[model samples]
Target: MGKSATAATLALAAARTGRSVLLVEVAGRSATAPMFGAEPPGYEEREVYDDADGGSVRCRSITPDDALVEWLSTHGFRRIVRRMARSGLLEVIATATPGVKDLLVLGRIKALEADDDADLIIVDAPAAGHALGFLRAPVGVRDTARTGVLNRQAREVLEMLGDPGRCRVMLVSIPEETPVNELVETSFAVEDEIGLALGPVVINGIVPPLEGLDEPLPSGPPPGVSDVELTEMGAAARLRRERVALQGEQLDRLAERLPLQQLRLPQVFGTTLGPDELRTLSDALLEGVGSLEAWA
Candidate 1:
């Protein structure tokens, strides 16, 4: 669904408004850095973009193992956890407890939120399926542990997730059938099961329709062009028109199925996306964000 790029674009858009933004990746992936033409960041935060104003965007990757280690170390169990980690027991611990690993990661994010680490923190969560489990982890852990520090932490994270002022879940999907179907389901799950407020849904990879696609081709080729090229061009245009119509049908289906506002992102033509493409995307995102009544 291109959430990593969306995260980067949203961070830059916020930064342009003189707001410090922290872009976090939870799955240990480094997809966002390349958009800014920067290197992959470790757990430690690195400044990827600095606007001329006081705004900036910092990025970091947070894995469950690393988050668990940091959480334990903060509670004065550094030596013990380090030994367990070395013995490969960490994997066992994370796997044995269904939602503990995810809770640990969310705990770190909660701490950042509480401490006001940045004006905004954008977490690039896992894909749709994993994301549902990711967001529901705190609730599961809280219910499992009736009395303990883990319970307390899980409850706090749950509170943050449910609070509209503190957090909002934004589901991303491309303008296609299967993705849109999954997105609609995920949106309902986030609202009904997780009880979280939703931000605008992001519709990525929207191909703008070409003009004069319906215009009939001339009988003969124009200057500096052959008849064969003209026929091929017409065929390509017709294909594009078909694709645009398909996208429109999917868009309409999404709107009817889900009641959330949408933010549309244009598809980049180049094979690779860089700073220039990122800037274009961020501008489009900013325009969409601005149009929202809540943001306004």
Candidate 2:
């Protein structure tokens, strides 16, 4: 973990377009702030959003419940649910079933970017496993709710998801066996089931091979090492390189299904970057693409 990282790359990339971005994360353990050098107090949108290169990116986090309830209220949901929370029932209201949580998380992302003031909404979403569940949410809720406010919003979200111009789902994964397998499934699920438009894949923590060493290098360590220490010395680095290979293979498979735009970033440094790293990320993503493209 000696190199600079780009955990908030997507968020910074989206915000660089002069759009008001709603960078959302599902995990209770916050991971996004250090990429930007500071955390907001709970949910407040701090004005001076600085990146590693000393630039600015605005971000906000909303709980899954808040996202849904706010979207409903904004799009005209009945007050019973929104009001009950006001009457001192956060524990009661926020603790809905898992499906309900998924519904709200997506609804918030969809609704927040509707206003003229807002431009982009980058979701850190859940990590590999739950992240797929988060994408499956619209269809899942639509089928189960059947009728009423839940069903209606489910329909709206799903419709938006299907339109390639409105929503784009992207995957972030390290090049490793388990995550690569999960991403393959995610690609299939988004197309066949949830019916979402997908964009390029971001391959995080890619280990760089020595540049310009064209011929395939020898597999073993330097000539002067004992076998035991050689095994230990090479283990971690070997695994890291193996993951980079795994990512390349996964991207090739994913490309057969769709246009796979890939961004490869090295492992993060022990001491995180401030505005400087954010700028590097923003520049990297914008090097080829224009907008974040909510849709394909």
Candidate 3:
């Protein structure tokens, strides 16, 4: 949810600036789809949001099997594609290849970008540990297949990923102990392993400061007439305040350690994030990171 929120916020920001944006979910995850209150996106692209100015954001989930079938179909191997899909051999092959899944997904993204399908594409990449493998797939294939179409495709994808103007990798994290630590480590890993600079570190789930919680509590509940209940409520507020302070401390530590730009998204207090909450998040992102025009 943390990473997906950041991705969706960024997509909305870009769309507001009159740009056609594509929000992609890699790693076969459903985080982005649920945020938009839609069924999880399948292999094909679907419009998720449309703005008044004729700008829109589309979402799609890419998987190795689907990409392979699409690729084969384009090459006049439709029957083979169907056979592989129906026989369950596609999953086996995708599983056997270490980074092919990631490479296929990257190829899809590059095609979308190159074909002018979207002015901007925001990818909700895998979590830190798996993301490293995903980012390295292009380089791995480029190095191994030196004289074939695969090698050429890999080279192109690598160029797109390494181009700062074209691609910016953002790391999303929460203001918690483990997520913060993983963000730091993943930042380093991305730079060292993938040779790409992180654009920003989006810190989500920030607890808003509690107002009027510091004042002295009344001796008794005004209408409920239960001192015990009042005391419990006060205790809960104090605990929430403490948590907010701790999160602030964690943010400070992250700022001191990481040299990347940081953006904070407040903790959304609800069971699910709908259009309203997404708009609220986009507003926060715009305030913190400025307009998406700069990126465009």
Candidate 4:
């Protein structure tokens, strides 16, 4: 996945099919805001993209601190919540507890899932390492706490996460050595360790096939070009071609190893991705996945 770019594109793809989609950023990163040209979202979901058919994409960034506050408020601890926020006790609790932070974040997601505000809730989870921990947090808590509200909450979250119909974890990767390797390991961890149904793997930033590149390079620049510049350009092109070939090999390896559906998104060359680029990627995604109804 291109991370935020991929998340935003997927959300847009769902919204284009006249479905309400909620994009959640669980890594405390703000990728959807900039993609939609809006300010960073807080705990509250805000409409980032509105489809012509009355469907929309709402995005929110969920952090441990904010989730804790929300939890406290819901439990009739508004005064305590304010004091904790002012004294930085919230941060302390979020930091001190190993998996509690992740639990709180998932709790928030569970609330959204129960609310049924959107047809699809796409969580732009953390990277593979932290994401694995996040998904496993509930199970860890459930096992540690024999009896309590915490144990009950953890069980509920675990059920939702493990449900095949409700939850699907999608892994995103670039066609490279390190990222692909990490993705392969992460996929195993998701199914084996986390016990969740893994969804499609989106291979992002794939280099398109370069046509007419089999011919040998010219001896020199065609006109008004220095030898040094031409040589450097040739080297760069050769490197790009080599990288594309290597990426293809990596993709093949991933396909062979993992049985999940694979989708490829071409590398969009641009400094910033706007709606136009996102639309293009979304179309590619729909084409690869077959239909939006399938995702829902």
Candidate 5:
């Protein structure tokens, strides 16, 4: 599925069962807010929409001030994150490349996602670098301090991440070579260094219809086809077919290496995608890999 698709899945997964969850939009261009129909975006925990039954799916603020303060408070760090913020630490850190911002954000996300009773908490993590910060934060803290509030917080976050029963890392990427390569590289790096379990690799924006492959190839000698036209069309069709086949093969390799669940989403042939599109993506995600309903 696409990022929006994954976000929707995680959101519903959070509310699955009888737990309350927060879909934290901490960083990046588009957070999960768009998936649920929150517009005129702001930085505060607001209920944009609800599950089928209309229960709230909280959209939290992404501003530094809010992220630090709220995260500390909810994660029992009302003072710690605040103190860090006041000391200019959080500010300086937030100003760093996005990945760092993601650590702090995920720490907060973990605060909410970590709730035992909560079904799932989806955080639209920062870019690859920023996300790495969150994924590897535990190692930094665990090796640095013997004891302290930050240390404790880091430890809790680390433990939560390390435990497979609780946390799962979903690496999102396109079927293209670059993104696929990065996904594989990121997976190995995260696992070997952080000892974190990489759950599913979501391959988004898959290409041209493959479910129609055997229906007499769009290439095979068309009725009354000219040699020249047939040659070009056949070549194009063959290339398209090869690309799709390669994506599937690569995806299979990724799944085998990590033994991660693969969620592939078809290319949306739309001029633009908004809430309606997100809803569509969300529906596709839920159609399989069923999880808790957002309002359950």
Candidate 6:
């Protein structure tokens, strides 16, 4: 679905507004760093892009194990953090408890939010199913802990997740049947179940409609083009036309079902997704942002 690329583009878009942006990946995949032409960043945030107008983008990756160790160390359990890690107790605990790992990661993000480290933070969350679990972790912990530091931390994380002014989920999806269906379902789950506010949906990988796709192929091959080559070209053109029509249908259906504004990103071809690609997508993202009433 190009979520990582979209996150990087969004970081660039936000940075262009003279706001510092932090791009965070919770799944431990340092996908954003590569797009910025940088090496993978670990737990420490590293500057990826610097805007001329005093804004910039930084990126970091957070894993559940690392978060848990840090959480324990900061919460007065520092003495046991090493032991727990060395003995693999941390993994056991995280696996046994359904949402503990997610809660730890969210807690760290909550702390970052509280510290005012960046003007805007874009989290490259996991896929739809895990994202739901990730958002719901704080709630589960808050309920289970009830009256301790853990509960307090969970409550604070929930506050961050639920507050629209502080945070909002931007869902990314390709224009297709199953993905669109999942996006709609996830939006509802986030709103109805988690009560988290949503930002504009990003529709990635839109293939621009070619002007002459509907016209018939030439009756005969041109110079240097064989009949077989022409036939293949016609077939490819037909596929493109069908794909464009299908994407249009899905986009319309998405608007009717989701009702939120969408930011459409053109399908990038042939490029290896480096700084140049980020700039192109960022420009497109900013244009889409400009059209939204809230952003304007």
Give all candidates' CA lDDT scores.
Answer: 0.91, 0.63, 0.83, 0.86, 0.64, 0.90
| TM match of model 1 to true structure | 0.96
- Candidate 1 shows a clash count of 0
List of clashing residue pairs for candidate 6: none
Expressed as tens digits, the lDDT of each residue in 30-66 for candidate 4 is: 8787787777788888888998997799999998888
- Top-scoring candidate (lDDT): 1
Clashing pairs in 4: 1-172, 1-173
Q: Which model, 2 or 3, shows the larger lDDT?
A: 3
For model 6, the stretches where C-alpha displacement exceeds 4 angstroms are: 92-96
Which stretches of candidate 4 lie above 4 Å from their native place?
A: 92-97, 218-233, 291-296
RMSD of 5: 5.8
The TM-score that candidate 4 achieves is 0.92
Model 5 steric clash pairs: 14-120, 16-292, 44-61, 72-77, 72-78, 99-130
Q: What are the per-residue Cα lDDT tens digits for candidate 1 across 1-296?
A: 88988999899999999999999999878999889999999999999999999999999998989998898789888879989899998888777667999998999999888889799999999999899999999988888888889889999999999999889998999998999999999999999988999988999999999888999999899998898899999999999999999999999999999988889999988888899999999999988888877731
lDDT of 3 at 289: 79
TM-score of each: 0.96, 0.71, 0.91, 0.92, 0.72, 0.95
Output the number of the TM-score-best candidate: 1
Model 5 misplaced stretches (Cα beyond 4 Å): 1-5, 12-21, 28-30, 54-56, 70-103, 113-118, 208-239, 290-296
Sorted on lDDT, highest at the top, how do the candidates line up?
Answer: 1, 6, 4, 3, 5, 2
Range of the 10 consecutive residues with the lowest summed lDDT in candidate 3:
287-296
Cα lDDT for residue 167, candidate 6: 90
lDDT (10s digit) by residue, model 2, range 76-174: 555676566677564454445447677776666666656534455566666656766877776777787789878887788777778877777777666
- Report how far off residue 76 is in candidate 1 (Å): 1.2
- Preferred candidate (TM-score higher): 2 or 3: 3
